[model samples]
Target: MTESKLRDIRWIFILLAAYFALQVGVRLATSHSLDLDEAEQVFRSQWLAAGYGPQPPFYNWLQYTVFQITGVSLAALSVVKNLLLFISYLLYGLTARLVLRDKALVAISTLGLLTIPQMVFEMQRDLTHTVAVFFSASIFFYGFIRSLKQPSLASYLIAGIGIGFGLLAKYNFAILPAAALIAALADARLRPRIFERRLALTAAVALIITLPHLFWLKDNLDFATARTLEKMTASDNASYPMQVAMGVSSLALAVISFAGLTVAVFATVFGKKLRSALAAQSEWTRLLERMMLVFLTGILLLIVFGGAAGIKDRWLVPMLFIVPLYFCLKIEAAGEETDKAFRRFMPIVTVIMIGVPAALYGSVATARFSGHYERLNRPYAGMLEILRKQAEPAAILAGDSLLAGNLRQDIPDIHVLSMDYPGFKPDISGRRPLLLVWLIPHKGENEALPPAMAQWLRANLGVSAPEALVIGVPYVYGRGDDSYRFGYAWVHPPS
Candidate 1:
């Protein structure tokens, strides 16, 4: 903590203030409803209780806390996300300082990395990525730094436990242990200190943290094989147009973010002379860079496959965890003349990256604010209103999975008796002869039930089915009467 080091931290704090000021303002102005994922967490958080339907409880629990502390509206809770996001940036900046040890360089790199939209958007939205990224990076960097002072049982415990919190946010964080192993091996100073005995202690801590989620995952999706299936199924999103966009947008983000961490990654690979000459004189410093690289490699794999397959830009956002480290590279990756050019334009690009996403987000918010539009959740808002008004407290109905989330929000007392798998099931009661509902389609457009279920439902109910079914993709009511999107909502009148 030299005077110079202290001054550098102050400057980073200043930059953080400026970045989030714009981000939070944008969040406030744009009024988008909870996203499908957000709604999933909220519904799970509110309805399902301790362990929400097939998902880990930690993220939902955090959302519940925000709901309790800040109330149900997502706006205030979004502020908490802002805080987590801030922590992530600080962690990245701190990593930058540790490597480059240059205040100006660290500031520029951090600014540049924040431009990756998913990172900023996750920070603004009330979801677990913020908490996961924040705790995971904070813990790893903290323990990694501490190991240098005097390797201790407690330091490893802290690092392992921090990753535990990260796992609670998302299962992919389990990759952290591998990063630690690689970093320790690569780091000359930290290597000898990290022998079998110390590594075992870290392993035990990580294992202890993992048990509960393991239990939760066991029933829903086999954590190991299920992730691959989930990844494969996600390929449905890779439309011709989507593949192109995913490739371009994801790569652009990765390159920009890597630019931020370039110095640290490069230096870790080759910065032996430079780091030893500077501060702390701990061999562990290089370990930190390689550790981050291992982390980066895992994320890069996820993105490459995820993007080609059409996974959401935002789903893999946690991997943006490496951006701040990448920022350092942008500064240090180049030699003198090239470095000067990067210095001149890097900050501007950083600002543009952050600003443009904020603007797009703001536009989304504005659109929601101006009109009663329906996305995944809101489109069902009107339908849920209709169902609530029409159905009995015990009405049994099947539903689209997307709409089930929203209907659950409105019809707390209503039960989803049954539904097609992989779609929304509104009925929680899980009993027989459920009063099925359907949207009457125009003639020749009735959706056929899948063969097996259609046979089963018909056999039990003892009738040829009517010309209709209650479920559709919760179509919305637009400005004028247009049957294109909204199907006429009708229940079967008594036979």
Candidate 2:
């Protein structure tokens, strides 16, 4: 690399470093709020023996790689988190360079990805969304850029590889080809010649990449739908209006997310002069303009509830390049000068990029520490305390539904059992004394065990009906009717 070019890369690295420093410093300084998904990721990853469960294998693959590199410590995971964050930024940088030819505009777009709050946080968590987003951006960037240059076999082959990786990352990634094809078709000047032998090769490459995942799915036929069904039915969704509004905001937010593709899409599609102007531009710029339209349409499809949860906003993160590319196109059209519109939107983007997420997560972290909401998990230390106190070899114990999992984790050899199931009782004829842990204590349920929980406890725990059990209150909480109560601990027999 030339000296000046080396300096430019260094500048990009510094900005990315600053973004990551903020992410980890804030995550550590405030309290650690364990997202259930992240904890479950830790729980699952540790026990992972590869191909043992449902869901695609890539996330486990990525997390396992991180663990191997970092040596299984919390600090190591933190390092891994930052490492993934850096990789996401690097992919965005490459995507920007490919989509926006202007060096300055490309740098700014790179910054835009670096500071996106949703983008930043997604890296810290164990969600598969970031990797999906990375390949999604990659496929869009490489496919159209190649279409412009020479349409060489190698170029199409690379684009095909990107598409395949994207499919592995997310099911939604298939939208890219559909949107790109539609946009290309509309451009009469380009469509006929564009879909030549090379495009067919691209498709073939993607199919080749998708084959392994297809076979894996074939093996876990029931598990795929089973897992999808679980997430779909996980909870009762809210009112229709709220779901609709959420979908709208999530779709619309894509505009502000990185480069505000909405502005570019409107300028190109509805802007009175974009098509005429595009015909006169250099070939590479024309290719980029075509991509902006294609990418923007993909955003619209997402707003249409294209496999969205219809709730989580960051689900749209995979399409980060849309607006940035759009903004860059508009800037290029305006002779690389900062226009009035650019000036107006830039600060808003910056603030929303950094400020919004910090405020939202900051409030959530504060609320958690302040006892504003009920947490489903019991303290690991508290569980350990109870185990040490009860200290008996082969102790027969039962835990609330949640406790059974960690109880086994924290005290493996104990005859730990569940009160959630029917006739699950102590191995009385065995040597361990009986004890119970409520990994999750619900006040109302504990105060008066539900008939199901009560019967299960009585029949399986070797306890008498009703009041014969002495319960120890563990965690405190507020009920639905605005009441405070404790989820108490229980001893099967009131000895």
**Best model number under TM-score:** 1
Taking the tens digit of each residue's C-alpha lDDT, what string does model 2 give over 9-95?
566767667766666665555333234434433434444332434445555456667755654433444555666557656655655
> Per-prediction TM-score, please?
0.65, 0.63
lDDT tens digits by residue: candidate 1, 101-138: 55556665566455555555444444455456555756
Give candidate 1's whole-model lDDT. 0.52
- What is the Cα-based lDDT of residue 131 in candidate 1? 59
Q: What's the true lDDT of residue 63 in model 2?
A: 62
lDDT of 2: 0.52
